[model samples]
Target: MKTKKMGIQKHYYLMMLPGMLWLLLFSIVPMFGIIMAFQDYNPGQGILHSEWIGLENFRYLFQLDDSKQVIVNTLIISIGKIILNLIVPLIFALLLNEVRSLRYKKFVQTVVFVPHFLSWVIMATIVIGIFGYNGVVNTIAGWFGGQPRLFMADPSIFRELLIGTDVWKEFGYNAVIFLAALTSVNPNLYEAAAIDGANRWQSMWHITLPELTPTIVLLGVLALGNILNAGFDQVYNLYNPLVYSTGDILDTWIYRLGLQNLQFSLATAAGLLKSAVSFILITVSYVLAYKFADYRIF
Candidate 1:
């Protein structure tokens, strides 16, 4: 009987082998290139034969005048996106939950979710068309006697644009998880609250929100890991030299350094720093989630 059970489970183990191998080959193996971060990496000499200069690359990164600004931009944009992503989705989900009309709920959900499926490349064009100097936004402004402003070129508004567009793109997708959590909540709880003199708002505030707390905390923890990633594709597609002072994040800076300027080692070092910081953030977030919310992602 034991042998039969073991043989049955062996196929399950075999089913997981391909994915494990893929992760090893693609993810784990490439991490070995991190050694290039500490070296004066030469393509002709290759990684193994390249000259090692410990911490020099990191020193060079900080020496650049734009480096601090880039780091600040990344954090500001990412953190803003993270907060808005959670709040907008939660509010939308709560509002949608209140709608008794299933047809209307589904229609609204579908409309909002369509944006998430569109690639950033396509969405960037749409965003530019709407916010350009003579675009739809300026046209609307003109109707109200407002001046035409160069939104894309303005450093002051670039970060706001990044955050707003990212939130608009992803809020619906994020809300789906909250909506699912809403489904698991027992309807009887709502009924009980009503019998105890609770109104719809009171029921939602007391029963619905509390039930959604664990899921919120778990997703929040996961988001903390990406605090340094400020949507490279969107920024790259929409940004210009005029806005680079406020809009350039770590990834864009790295691209220009490594690809355009040929500072391979410096780029690698910057990337390695980003990964290390993200890992530490994720680990700390997981620990806090477990401690505070009794939520364990793993």
Candidate 2:
């Protein structure tokens, strides 16, 4: 029996070999470049021969005005997404759960979920068209004698746009977990609540919400790990100089710094900082998930 079990496990390990190699080539190998953060990296000289300047890049990174603004923008956008993604999905799942017609429920779920599968490349174009100076929104506003606002270019509302669109795109996918959690809820609880003269809202409030609490807490805690990841693909595709004040995130700033401005050291420092913070947050989030939600990877 032990020999048979070992043979089965060997096949599983063999299956994982390709993924492990991919990770090594892409993720693990590129991590060696993190040393550039502490060096005046010269492409011609290569990483090994680059001039070492310990902590200078980090000090300069902290002193920059753009760094502070980008950090603030990232936090605001990510936090907004996290909060809305949690609440909106939970509410949507609850509302969908109450629907009597199975056909309507499945159709609504399918319609909302389609956006999640679409890449940000496609979504950003659609968003830009909708919010452009002469797009559908402005065309509609023109009829009401209102000025055509440049929604995409406006700095004041740019963050809101990013957050709102992200929530809209992801809430349907996020709600799936909530819907699955709802199924595990004892139907007898609802039956009992109905016998006690409870309405739909009352039953949901008393029974459904309580049953789904663990899932909600688990997802919310897990989301803390991504607090710094403010959707690079979405921001990179949608943002411009006009909206930089509000829309620029760490990833976008790093791209401009390194690739555009040729400030490799500074960009690497910024990236390293983000990676370190993300690692810490991810560790903390997993610990919290284990404690609060009884989640365990092993």
Candidate 3:
């Protein structure tokens, strides 16, 4: 029996070998480049022979006006997405639960969930077409005797547009968790509430919301880890120089610094700072999740 169990475990370990090797090649190997954050990285000299500069790159990063603006943009966009992603998905799940027609519910879910699978590359093009000067939005405005406006180029509303579009794109997919949580809610509670003269609103508020509190808390706490990750792919594809003031985020800024401007050391320093902060946030979020929601990986 022991020999048979050992054989089975060995097969499992073999299966895991490919993934472990991939991680080492891509993720673990790249971590060695973190040394560049403290050095004046030179391509000819490479990471090893580069002049070590300690915290100078960090000091320069903090002094940059562009860096300040980028940080502000990242926080604003990320926080907006987090808050709306939480509230909108929960509301969507609650409303969906009230849907009695199974076919209609499934249809609506399919329509919304489809966008989540679509890459940001595709979605950015669709979004540009919709918000373009000659697009549907401006065309509608022209009907109301309003002048056509370039919605995509307007810096004032850029952040709001990013948040709104992200919420629309993801709310349906995010709602799946809440919907799953809703299933575990006892139908007896709803029946009892209805018998005591509770309306749909009353039942949802008093019974459903309470039942889903732990899930809501758990997801919200976990989301704190991503507070710095303002959608790089989406923003990178969509934003232009005109919208840079309001739309540029840390990832895009770092990309431009390293690849575009050839400030490799500065970019690495910025990336290191982001990684360090993200690590701390992730640790704190996990602690909070464990304490408040009784959530744990192990």
Candidate 4:
């Protein structure tokens, strides 16, 4: 078996050469740049000559109030997004599945999916037009005897707005996965339940939901792995210093520290920390998925 495996390995390696080269050049080579996080890295000093500070960069980050806020905001935003992301999409998918009219079903699905394709910069402009102080939401609220509120400016509401917008943008794309899972469920189960006098709600609760558990669990685990990444593009586009207390996440914090403040070493350290946590989370999730949920992407 070992000899045969070696023979097949040669053929596999030959076929995978180009892709392997791409990964090496693009992914692996670039990761070596992470060494800057451990050093008082100077661009002129280059990688080898930079003064090594060991874990000083990480320690300094933990000592900073702004850094702590970044971590807190990242977790809060990500968790909020995760909950909303699953919920709205699941509800929409279930509702869409019930629609009898093919034309309306297609139209709703298409319209919902449109936002997923839009860039966050463009979406930010749309959000401003709808949620800014004079925007649609405040305008509607004003008509109801409420004062015009700054939705984006208020730190308390920024997280909510971020999660809501993310949900709106990504829900349709996520619904596609659920819709596919729903289609694969055996119709005979629904039929059997119907014959046994199960109503629509009962059949949905018993048949449809149980069939969706594995898929739900699978996606839940994947989302959990990404719980620190609250989205750079969205937050960067939508946020300002006014709401940074609640809006600054790990990625955005790094952007300010490195790009804006020119503290490249500190920013790199923060990024490396996030990447390390994400790596561990993803690995653990994959293991659990295989052991209990049988989640296989391929």
Candidate 5:
């Protein structure tokens, strides 16, 4: 028995060797910089000679006005995106499921999903063009006797702009996941409801949505873990200093501070804190998933 188990373990190691090596090179080695979050990192002194400040980086981060705004902007943008992303896609998927025309359904799905494949950098250009001072959207607003507000440039509107643009980009792709889950729900359930004289609305509310609850909860759990992400590419490309009050996220903040401004320790600490929070949230979610939902990840 022991020999057979040893052979199985040897085979597993052989299968995992390359993947483990890749993780070591890409993940573990880079993770060493997490230590810098505890140090007063300096380019001249390097990682080894850097002074260890322990929790000072965290203390400094909390004390700064910019950091407070940064955290607030991140949470608002992320939470808003989370709500819009889920509600819009799920609603879309539900509505699309009602369409009986295969050709039209496929065409709409294809068109909507296309944006997800495009890079945010590319989409940002399109967004700028549409929402610019004299772009198509602004021109349309002129017909309504309204002035063109700079959605991307205005601090007051930047959070909404981020949420709106992100929803536009990824909602269709998100719908595909919900659609797949929707497909798995038993067709007989719908048929039985119809035979029992249930209205389409009743079937949707009582049967369809209830069947979708587990998948929704699973996705929600995943989204909740990243309540701090707030999207770097979207914010970085779309934001100007005029809108930084509402548009700055932890990711964008870290990139600008760590890479561009070279505030290594401070930036790393911000990222580290986000990571710590995300880790705790994900851990708690998984525990709940197992305890309450009886779901196992592996």
Candidate 6:
């Protein structure tokens, strides 16, 4: 019996071998390049021979004029998206779950999920057309005798645009998880609530919402890892010079520094800072998940 169990465990280990190897090769190995954060990295000299300047790059990063603005923009946009994304999806999932027609529910889910699969490049053009001076939005405004606003170019509105568009794009896919959580809720609980004179809203508030709390906490905590990630592709594709003041984020800043400005060392330092923050957030998230949600990811 012991030998049979050992053999079964060996098979399980074998099944995990490929994924483990891939993670080690792509994820763990590349982490060694974090050394560039502390060095004045030179391509010609390469990483090994690069001049070591411990914390200098980080110091320079903090001293930059736009650093504070960029961090503020990143946090505001990301947190707004995070909060909205969770709320929108959970509400959407609950509403969809209430629909009696399975076909209509699936159709709505499909329509919403379609946007998630669309690349940001494609969506950017669509957004531009809708928000442009001569576009649908402005044309509609003109009908109401309002001014044609430059949405993509306005610093004041750009962050909101980023957040709104991101939430619209991702909420459907996010709701899928919530929908799945809804399925795990026992039908008997609803029946019991209904027997006690609970309405739909009452049942949802008293039973369904409580049942979904663990799932919500788990997803919310996991999302904290992205606190510093303010959608690089979406923002990069949509933003221009006019909006950079309020829309520029850590990822975009890193891209400009490394690719455009050739300040590779500074960019790496910024990237390192982001990764460090994300790691801490994820760690805290895991701890919270365990404590509040009674969930363990690892």
- List CA RMSD, all candidates: 2.5, 2.0, 1.8, 2.8, 2.2, 2.9
lDDT of 5 by residue, 109-166 (tens): 8899899999989999999999888887898999999888776677887788889999
In model 6, the runs with Cα more than 4 Å from the true position are: 1-29
TM-scores vs. true structure, each candidate = 0.90, 0.94, 0.95, 0.91, 0.91, 0.89
**Residue 77 shift from truth in candidate 6, angstroms:** 0.8
Predict model 2's lDDT versus the native.
0.95
Go through the candidates in order and give each one's C-alpha lDDT.
Answer: 0.93, 0.95, 0.95, 0.91, 0.89, 0.92
Candidate 5: where is the Cα deviation over 4 Å?
1-14, 143-146
Tens-digit lDDT track for model 2 on 58-92? 99999999999999999999999999999999999
Show model 2 residue runs off by greater than 4 Å. Answer: 1-17
Better of 1 and 3 by TM-score: 3
**Poorly placed runs, candidate 3 (over 4 Å):** 1-15
The superposed Cα distance between candidate 4 and the true structure at residue 136, in angstroms, equals: 2.0
Expressed as tens digits, the lDDT of each residue in 24-62 for candidate 6 is 999998899889988999999989999999999999999
**Residue 248 local lDDT, model 1:** 98
lDDT per residue as tens, model 4, 139-180: 899889999988889998899999988998999999999999
Give the C-alpha miss distance for residue 87 in model 1, angstroms. Answer: 0.6
Supply candidate 4's per-residue lDDT for 94.
86
Predicted candidate 1 versus true structure: per-residue lDDT over 86-178, tens digit per residue: 999999999999999999998998899999999999999999999998899999999999999999899999999999999999999999999
Question: Which run of 10 residues does model 6 get worst, by summed lDDT?
Answer: 289-298
In the predicted model 4, the residue pairs found to clash are: none
Of 1 and 2, which scores higher on TM-score? 2
Model 4's TM-score against the true structure: 0.91
